[model samples]
Target: MEETTMLSLLPPALALLMIIATRKVLPSLGVGIIVGALILNDWAFIPSVSLIWEAFSSIFVSEGAINDWELFIILFLLILGIMASLISFSGGSRAFGDWALQRVKTRVGSQLITLIFGILVFIDDYFNSLTVGQVSRPLTDRHNVSRAKLAYIVDSAAAPICVLAPLSSWGAYIITIIDDILSDYSGIAYSGLQAFIYMLPMNFYALAAILFVFLVIVWKLDIGSMRKHEERAIVHQQLLDPTRKNVPGDHSQDLDTHHGSVSDLVIPIVALIISTISFMIFTGARAVDNATLLTIFAETDVARSLVYGGLIGLGASVLLTLSKRPSPFQMLRATWNGIKSMLPAIYILILAWIIVTIIDQLRTGEYLAGLIDGSIPTVFLPALLFIMAGLIAFSTGTSWGTFTILLPIAGEIASVLDLSMILPFLAAVLAGSILGDHCSPISDTTILSSTGAGSHHIDHVVTQLPYAILTAIGAFIGFLVLGMTGSTLGGLLVTLLIIVGIAFSLKSVITPLPEN
Candidate 1:
């Protein structure tokens, strides 16, 4: 492998800064890709152009064949968009909203329901975000909950919940990585599953993030940008900010939504959830002999499974829409409108993927990971590793990639320093990757969370930042305590107290937007 220096950091850093400044994601990602390409080609114009083209093309074709993973993900997104449109046209979303309105009487209840749905869909983060958004949007909107807050709830529940659930796709992937890392050290007695279970308590960020979502909703602790969004929703009945021109996954204007029942929405979503889980099991089972549930998930093709499940869900949605006896023109319009709504998300996703590829070529993650050394104090290792992993994931816009790169380094470091500290170091990396993923504007999960909630992507990113940062502060403190005391319980208790204190303090001083 080629050695990468600090130069690798320029593209993502510039991209992040530009996104914050301009609030324009596409141009920001484009500039980042160009800068990375130029750096790789040493500022040679023609070579850089060629590199950029190659990077873009690689998304569709890799190794002279179709890139199944990327294409499948795109297909699933389109399918989901179409399904959402069909559901709206069939009146299912409206019906479900009315039904929920009768039972969920308060804004808090609606938000809590959204949070509960997020927690239940732990199979995959992508699935969780979109599915939860689809189910919870109508209820939240009816209760005047802002799309930004819904997106925050969806995003918070995604990576954090998936990381903790052993039966989830995230869990399987992490377990595999942990197993590989463990292979290098001979004296370790526990298996990957055992290590993962042991480290669960040590993953302070994920735990804190999940708790933060619940507490924020129950306590009405809206602060910063989130407060502005909530105030608009409550006072003006505007679920979306007026300035947000492009709200992804919004099909309101495109569909009639006046003629169907609750079954129209519930049936398709149920099919999607069941079929996706079935496909995950099926695909995973085919890859391994003597497959246990754990092995099956570990070997599952997540992208492919999503595509398969999406097809089934789309089919169900089409049938439900047809049952409504809409005009042919209405059906076509709904389909087209759904696809159009997702186009923005698709465009952003492709550009994000391209930049991530370019960053990979520059070895940006490796460059970031290489910064860690033995000079760091043993007691500070967990907190430092958490910070380092967060930076790398933030720069790369990929938590799984961060895990792949940093986990081995963490293992090597622990082996040399203190073997018993392996779980803490590994747990810190898990926690930090999630924290960065939540904060990074370019992260796919973050993008999908916005799409799912039908919020302007930048709006979701901005409103969610303070909440993620607050949780991160708590996690950082927890990791510091864990490192010094080596007690997960002590760290967790301190983290909980700190989070509660900060949340209450913010709620007291940050005057909420008053009802008009």
Candidate 2:
């Protein structure tokens, strides 16, 4: 209530613990929100009850948290479900899978395709997760690739790629934050864009994540729970393990319903990508007059663009179906069925949003940022900031929020302690935020990726944790080296070697399951 004191941190900590214990995301989030409300209301049960109710309803209040962007995101997810359903109902997914099977014969190739798609959709993480998951799931399923692994690939591709892509939503968002931080310190005259570029090579975690995913594919490296999931899928042809209760949704929908061609799928996917890019440019241009394309991208409203893109994609799917002479009534039914299937994921997303809001109200990120705001040794600042940013992002379940909170603090700390460490510190904060967000079970992108892959949410988290930790280790060491030598190439070399070594060492412990 009064900044992020010890008591204020209790709610999120409790929430994370509950999620780990119960493996139920929604109720765990509710428990956390209630605790936060109780603390805010001075532990009065009746008042806390009312406050909890207010928390849910407040989003709907005029000009409240559920603004146009939020609504667009919600609609986009729903549309994704419908689009996925349409593809299945029209047999496009099945056709595509069949077509893929003829060309990509092995699990490795299937995964590589999924990873490539994830990398291609780099405009936004949200888009990348949904589109890649939907597009690749069928192919992966046919190849006995675990949904957990598919979700991992999708999640890795989404945010990691966006952060590295200079023209992406993540790049724009972080750049703006860095600009604000630069404004306060006259020691440097770097624009947000320039700062982002300067730190790009230093973003070891993001680079490592993308590389590690491909390495996992090429090396067939699976460890921890992920190995078990992969073994089950490949050896037993079991996609969803019966022991897991958190399956996102029923993925056994009719994928062989109609005599649809592969174009039914490809056309909609192409339309979605094209429409999204077009709308992004249009929106960005409207936001500024005579702005360069790159500047327009920096100014674009990604959520709104996604909304239009999803709608256009949906339209294209429907039209493609109609051209094949499907009944209009059948089309409506298919769309509605798809929407219904996504309700579970949507509920989890809404709950996640509410929990994030509660954490924000409690000033969790600010509290964590404040802990490391003061002076520190120059050599230790980069690594310390990375760890701190990761912790805050993990707790709050939002990398963007982590960026907004820590970028300024990192800037101030670097300026006061060692101006030369600025790039590494900023890079550490950015990379750490992505690492934490990737690993956090409550993260929205993680949830979306799980839904897209039709994997159990906790299962996805369990499987992805080890890989995320590996990347974080590389990133931490990279930051340490950067702080000491101020050499980007040296840090990059050390980080890459560490990650590659980890991969090789783990490969011996857990042999990849043989192809069936």
Candidate 3:
């Protein structure tokens, strides 16, 4: 019954995914949910069409099963939409472009700054990618650099850096999971949360990803199809007049107006940064309360950040409106448009929440977890964990889902093997999941990063996959060496040195495209 139920859910979900891949959003999602519902409810026959109505009715009329996490994600998307809109309209994005461009004259410079931002924001991948992509796009394009590369830079660094940062959101979650696995295992005396700070220095994948981005940028490594695209952008730029493209510099997405100058942008962004820090401090304080509060805090902080983000955005929009410089009304309209645009992502998240809930409730998670733990040999565990994580993220298009599904399994498997190894395995899984999400076009953060860059999401995905895969392979090898040698920090440093050596070797080959 268990296998049959899990297997039965696959076709409808897959059929729905096919539609999503084809870019049919609404119908695809409706069908996807129907498939899950039918399989779970065990109706005599699949209700392909009627199930849609039933879903709607249940979602609207019956509130019991509505997952709060889904709602939280929806609210997160809406807040992001509003935030992006405000940034654009209020000139925060423009100022960032101007200021960033001033410092990043070369491709190497842009890549470095992007890597730095990724390192700094080491919290939420969504926030990191969106922030870095939007702020850096103008500068990268100005350098005749490809948008796809910029997406690669942001996506590659976002989650990896976050997982490594002890104070950031990703770090916190990574620690919590580690803590759980350790608490249960006899030999593993330390908690996941406590050890992350220590193990962070030893995380090979995170170190390798950062180094890879720098190498790809400085060396301008043209792997796979990206080489061709680079040539095309260069040839195309050389033919056109430099002044012809942005003559009046129409930066506004809505109209033909020129993008504002640096001052126009910098202040609000600073405000946002300041505001975020302030909110973080407040939340951190509130989080330290009793266990019950901690649980609520865990459930709500990610969403609370969104709420704070949205509120900050609203305030920034108001100020921009008052400035009368770009026309505040336009900002308001754009913000609304932004929120509307986020609707699809919101729905997809809700469905993800539902599916995760189903998986948990069915107790199928334990059986699957057992199978996974028992099947893999002890020696191959870390490598297998990373590969499995990447596949799950690639298929589901969400790293969080991969984390939710994989962490426990990896933890249990670690218990089944040597409990002391849980941290390494879990870290590998997290890193691999992040790699897949960053590179996969279907992944929401990747999509949003492209959206932030004003590039076709598919183009970004195509361009990034090579670099992402290369780094992942490097990380995998590094993990294998560490597991075999039982050497912490040794593999990561070696990987970094290897990446740097490759970067220098490739440096002479890539010339900048003729200035646009």
Candidate 4:
């Protein structure tokens, strides 16, 4: 391991290939991390083992991966699942579905509306995915839209939009990380928080996601595995023609479920949202001076929201039981059942975070950071670096891991170049990570969103990639022009125009039919 730059990075790349080829995430991450650690330590057997151990240690060791944000996220998912089960038991979701059907008259309308619903839940990516998927799944199923496609739509919108939204918790985190960079550079006016609020309109990924959802609905253009499922569904219908084939009455999985009042659904969701806001305020997130003292409540938004939602559902169940007068033991059984049902989601979260931990400890990310800094050599390289960062994130299957490793490196590189471009590069890394997370099949959010939508995993992955790649290409062109011109806002404007051009081109390809 007497290192030459290019030669040293080969093992980690091979390991990533191993994971992706097998369609397995955790073991792949483990192998990649172990290989990376070994290389970083020059294959000095004991040190190499120690490096890998450090990676694994974070999962169980003090101040390790489990103790960080991953733990809160897993807990949040568990509580949300519990809340969802309770809502189902209480007939809230069903009631809301019935109300939606009454409002929507056609499949196309429902699909478009479901996309709208995805945009509506904008607080956090995790919250957005879980809420939108659960709410929209029933309607999409009714319309013969594959659950896999729905998952793609939900996942596409969730993280892409969350990072872009100024009002979200993501904005807060990004601002904290890059505050120093913004302050150091006079040209980049507006503080970190204020800049994001304005940049909301400029976020290429977020805009692309929202537009793509609408395009899919309006164009009715099917591609990738989604098209295959759609074709299968169509063929199944045609074969069952009354004149030519014996079509069994409804053999495909039925979307039927109990319908109830909107109050049942609306109450729990509203409670969750309001509770999140209150918790953030209570946690002193708005008060920097008290941030240390408020650390106790800082990460409680997810926990508080889920706990409130669960309790609210329990209260509703109580009211329903009291009106119908069920036995106490029966009620207890139902409540326990609700909690038990979330076990699968809990397991998925834990495994996903562990995989992320493995990827992070590999030290391979540092090599890429070094590579970007070395190769770029000038301010013009940030855009290309951004695209590369996205690719790394996608290949690795973890956005948090990508950001954690890349941000510091990008900052140091910017400092060396004196380009005053750290924030924008950080933005690129953030955006790149989002793009990768959006596209990567192994990404937890992608899988979770698919599961929540009741969609086939591979189907979702294939269908979504085209649109994300299109946006990425458009963003790259815009960023390229930015590197040459040396202007962030100017680059953003150009990117928006490129997106508009794509939208127009898409509109032309998908023309509407005239009435008979």
Candidate 5:
């Protein structure tokens, strides 16, 4: 671990393999954590057990106080779940579904609405996934869209859109890291924000992924396991796979959604969005003296703001539900069901966090970064970094972590070999991390997407892999073009052309699912 050895790769590899084989994410992560702990402790049983305990406890109790960031995130999830439940109990979801059905009128329209909503909620990926899922699920389900597909759409939008938006959590975090990287070298004319903007055009994966989502919806391009899920939805009217059990965030059969107006859902969602942005700016202002938009976003406490917004959203939901005048027993039942629905997601998140900690201790990312050597030609640097960053992120289940480890290495490599290529190299890392996060089963965004869509987690992961890979293929080609031609436009054009060709070819050959 200290020397960045290949041994660091084993645990995540084992966990991913087990997840694919068994379709049991929690147990796979638990096994990975145990194995990682054992490896870290030299295979000593007692020491490994102690390390595991410490890792688990540290999440809740850091430096003798509660870990506000981690706890607040959990709180936000619970609050959102409760709000969703109350909205359903008050008939907000059903009412909205009816309203959407009257206007939307087609599966393609419903999916497009979901995609647009996902893109608009780009302040944070977590907020985007859950909020879009909540608002779109009722509409999509009414249109006979599969939960797996909904989860895919949510997952695709979350990281890809956030990574591209300079006002988002992902952008803020990346900018801070870029600033640090810039300080290490001179003659780099661009500031962090400027560099981010320049690289936006070079972020092939993000752009390609977003475009692919639109194409998939418009072309009805359902392939792999996704086709099966879509067929089941259209033919049997089942949003989720019937064989899958213990799905997280599934309230399809648990709520009485028969008595509220469309405002019942809209008001709470609008309140949540407004309050969250307000708290983000407030908290960010307290952290910085200037209080400008960029600075505020860069310094903002995202998790804390989410918790505050969730409280307001929950309050709005409770007040609206109260107007319906449900009995005390019914209220309690709905609240319990809401809380219970989110427990599976909470459990998986904690386990994923623990395994991530173990992986960090193993120095898996550093080990991966160490693989790059000076012998490689500069023309291949962008493409290679993309693959490396993707592998690291896929293994670690964290795109930001991948960025932290690879960006510095990329900067160093570019400085030593070709300084002009710095932005392209950095852009590759960003694009790759998003690609990996989309594919990683243990990624928090991926897990939250499943929860939001009420899909079985494995189903989401399985169905999304092919789409993510296809985008990555387009991105990989784009990076190669950028490296050779030194033109962001050239790379982007080629990427789009390749994606369009592949999409149209697949559409022509594969039979579209029947309309219900």
Candidate 6:
């Protein structure tokens, strides 16, 4: 029953075609799911229809055969919506924006601060994307930063930071995958945790991404589509025209009427941050009978922690609003308004989840992995694995799924080639998956990042593409060198130098926006 034929490619190919044709995500994903269901049920009409219905229904249901992740994503996203609304209506965002403008005066400082903030929240990419986007959008906007650029920073920080942070939810899931795959292999000397650690320095895409953000911010090395967006945003700002509203995610109602203090914004954000970290630690601790900090962190339920944090943050927002003498009904109205603004994003997320389920059912990822399983030259194995993994993740729009499908294959291939090649190959898989996830328009993280930064989804993808490709180029070269030299440290140094050099060379093309 495993997917072995060319027919398995139908669903993803159709999905990609749909996305490119319509520039609309929902209908494309829906059509893809329907086709996948039909294929999965052997083209039987009634069974395929039934499968589609079940998939739709499964998005809200947490129990039973459906993955609990679906429910978690739905609830967490809704809660975040409510929280963002509450913060905005409470005048927290405006206050924070004003406060930030005073302290972070320059464009470079604003961007660097945004990047640093994004890096700090490394626990969960979902949380990182939403929180960083909502909190920093106003601040970044004050400095005339384009929503697309803000989206790029937020998106980059999400998965890339989590992948590198060993104590994050991403790291934990990777650890579990490694354990499952290596359980039967007797010759592998390193533990899953150790192997994961060994692969970290070799995660060139992540290093390139993080460093690239810094380079772009410090050197003003804006290039490609981003430069145009940046120029437009700056021009709009310089005109000081009150009628022009070029900001992307500023969908909220007028904030000029609210006379709330800066604490209104600052306090709720602090509450959300503290609550999320605390709940993560608490959940992780309880999950392990005898737990150290590492064990507790690794075992934490990411979605559940987000739920706890969202509720606490919501509570703080309510209390802060009430303290300002707002009526109870007014508070409710603000909360509802926040939820309403987030409805479009929530709808997109639900559809995305459904399509992912359908893709899983059709075994689209496995089919892609099988294509590169044993056909490549031995010397190019590491680089090839990276490229293959990137393609699978790009096509599927799911990096975690790509990791789950490709890591085991990479591990087995490395074992067959030479025991020493194991970690490098695994590292390649990790790097490639992140790169694909970072760039893919359909990626859940990418979607959420755009939602967070208030940028148009396509705008985010288009603007971020050139930077992501540059990083990928650096990573590919690094993998090639690693495969040839068989040295992790040397490969990493070379990759970092190459990316930095590429970044500097880009400076020659940097053209600042026109002055007022």
lDDT of each: 0.91, 0.85, 0.61, 0.60, 0.92, 0.79
Clashing pairs in 2: none
lDDT of 3 at 52: 44
Worst 10 residues of 1 by lDDT: 507-516
lDDT of 5 at 198: 93
The superposed Cα distance between candidate 4 and the true structure at residue 80, in angstroms, equals: 2.8
lDDT of 6: 0.79
Q: How displaced is residue 331 in candidate 3, in Å?
A: 5.6
Per-residue error (Å), model 5, residue 279:
0.4
For all predictions, the C-alpha RMSD in Å is 1.3, 1.9, 5.4, 6.3, 0.9, 3.0
Which wins on TM-score, candidate 1 or candidate 2?
1
TM agreement with the true structure for every prediction = 0.98, 0.96, 0.79, 0.77, 0.99, 0.92
Instruction: Sort all candidates by TM-score, best to worst.
Output: 5, 1, 2, 6, 3, 4
- Residues 466-492, model 3: lDDT tens digits: 777767777777777667776667667
lDDT of 1 by residue, 1-516 (tens): 256988899999999999989999999999999999999988898999998899888889998999998888888989999999999988999989999999999899998989898999999999998889988998998999999999999999999999999999899999999998998898999999999999998889999999888889887888878888898899889999887676789987755556778898999999999999999999999999999988999999999999999899999999988987888999999998889989999999999999999999999999889889898888999999999999999999999999999999999999999988999999999999999999999899999999999988988998999888999999999999999999999998888888888888877887655433
Error of 1 at 140 (Å): 0.6
Q: List the residue pairs that clash in candidate 5.
A: none
lDDT of predicted model 1: 0.91
The clash number for model 6 is 1
User: Clashing residue pairs, candidate 4?
Assistant: 58-65, 95-260, 147-455, 148-455
Quick one: best TM-score, which candidate? 5
lDDT of the structure predicted as candidate 3 = 0.61
lDDT of 1 at 24: 94
Q: Could you tell me which residue pairs clash in candidate 3?
A: 178-192, 179-192, 321-328
Clashes (backbone N, CA, C under 3 Å), per candidate, total 0, 0, 3, 4, 0, 1
After the best TM-score superposition of candidate 3, give how far the Cα of residue 416 lies from its true spot, in angstroms: 3.9
